[model samples]
Target: MKKLNIVFMGTPEFAVTILDTLYKSTEVNVVACITAPDKPAGRGQKINQSAVKQYTLEHDIPCLQPTNLKDENFIGNLKAINADLFVVVAFRMLPEVVWSMPPKGTINLHGSLLPQYRGAAPINWAVINGEKETGVTTFFIEKEIDTGMVIEREAIAIGENETAGELHDRLMHLGAKLTLQSVLKISSGEFEAIDQSQLTEEELKPAPKIFKPDCAINFDWDVQQIHNFVRGMSPYPTAWFTMHNTKADNNKTFKVFKTTLHSSKANEVPALIELDGKLILALRTGSLEIHEIQMEGKKRLTAQQFMQGYRPEEWEITL
Candidate 1:
């Protein structure tokens, strides 16, 4: 059998793992790597290459950075290489001219199981919605975004209190492994991509891109909601709220990382209490004990440790 010629497109660390794995396989030759252009980052304002681009450079692989995916020049270069297959992970949507070029077409590895959580930020949304399990899916890219036919899927249980960051790591590796499986099967002509609608599942919950307002914690929700929200947003674009001392008239944003749920009946004020050196947020059905937090421009501290130096008697949280 002839060895497969593949071209990969991706931009993040997650995508680099898959490309690295595929590049090592003897059955396929990764002809080229396509990633986003480097831009200035950090306080010093130096050029920062994407994780995929950095890996490509270090490995001496052919790399392309196209400011416009559909530009005639980029398209011309893609035709010149003439790869047989394409793989995408954590990359922008492709135009028909690019994705339809290869005989095997494009295969995408999504962070979440297909036909559900079909959008950006799947890992974050899964934890925020309190899902019991989540997984990765490899699918054939079609015209519609994420509405493609499924190639293969692997499910993993979500830990009772798993943070989004933890789940992200798990799915990242799992996606790499599953993508390898798909590539091998495709090379041998044993793979049959299945339609997502044929699987038959419940309603789909979108994983839309998260914004700053979405990360704001709402004390009016149930304690469990607050708990999930904190865990889901942990370590990135963290769940935050503005806290102020009514007497001092000073306000600062506090990012919540960890919390524990506790039942409560007293109709006390919401998210307003520092009883016994604990930062307590009174939710609708119970109290949320904030275990870990980071004040604006300060280091992360435990609730007990934070209360020891600060007084909540004059503090009031806004949203």
Candidate 2:
């Protein structure tokens, strides 16, 4: 059997796992890696390399960082690698020249099952929408974005209390395994591609990129909806609310990191802070016990720690 020549393209940590797995497999040889250019980050503002770039450098694989996908020089360099296949994960959209360079064609590993949640941030949107199940898909990249033909897929059930961070880790590992399977099967010409349009669109869901406004909490909704929103944005771009104290004449915003819903008979108004010496708020359907929080210009702290030296007589929360 002939070893397949592969070129990998990715940017984030989610893509690094599959690259590591492929490096160990004997059937595929990664000729080069393509990732976004390093950008300034942190307080020092030093250039920070992407996860895929770090992996490629550590493994002594050729790396390419192209600011312009259509640049003649970049395209020329990509063709010089002479790779038979291209594997993409957590990367930006590719032009026809790049995806068409390989004879065996290009395949992408998407976080969600094809035909559902076909966009950026699939894991985040899945939990935010309260989905019961989601999975990973390996597919043949077509002209349209994420509207590709499926090669292989594996579905996993979403836990009732699972957060976006938890789901992201689960799919990251699953995507790696599934991508390896697809590569091996394709290398031996033992796989078939299924058109994504053939799948039923009756229940299709989109996974659009999240923004800062999307992270703002809306307390007017029911408890379940708010809970889903909290979990979906937990650990990153957390759900937040504004607090105003009438007696102290102060206003502050707090971001909620972790919370649990508690049954309460108090009919406190929505977005109202019911302080019992701790940070507890009343939701539309139930009460919320804030586990972790961060006030403006302050580090994250537990509810107990936040209440240690701070006490407000009467405070109202604005959604």
Report the C-alpha lDDT of model 2 over 230-285, residue by residue, as the tens digit.
Answer: 88898786888888877777888888877777666434576444465556667657
Question: What TM-score does model 1 achieve against the real structure?
Answer: 0.94
Every model's TM-score:
0.94, 0.94
Residue-level lDDT tens digits of model 1 in 40-92: 99999999999999998899999999999999999999999989889999999
State the C-alpha lDDT per candidate: 0.88, 0.86
lDDT of 2 at 241: 82
Superposing all C-alpha atoms, what RMSD in Å does each candidate have to the true structure? 1.8, 1.9
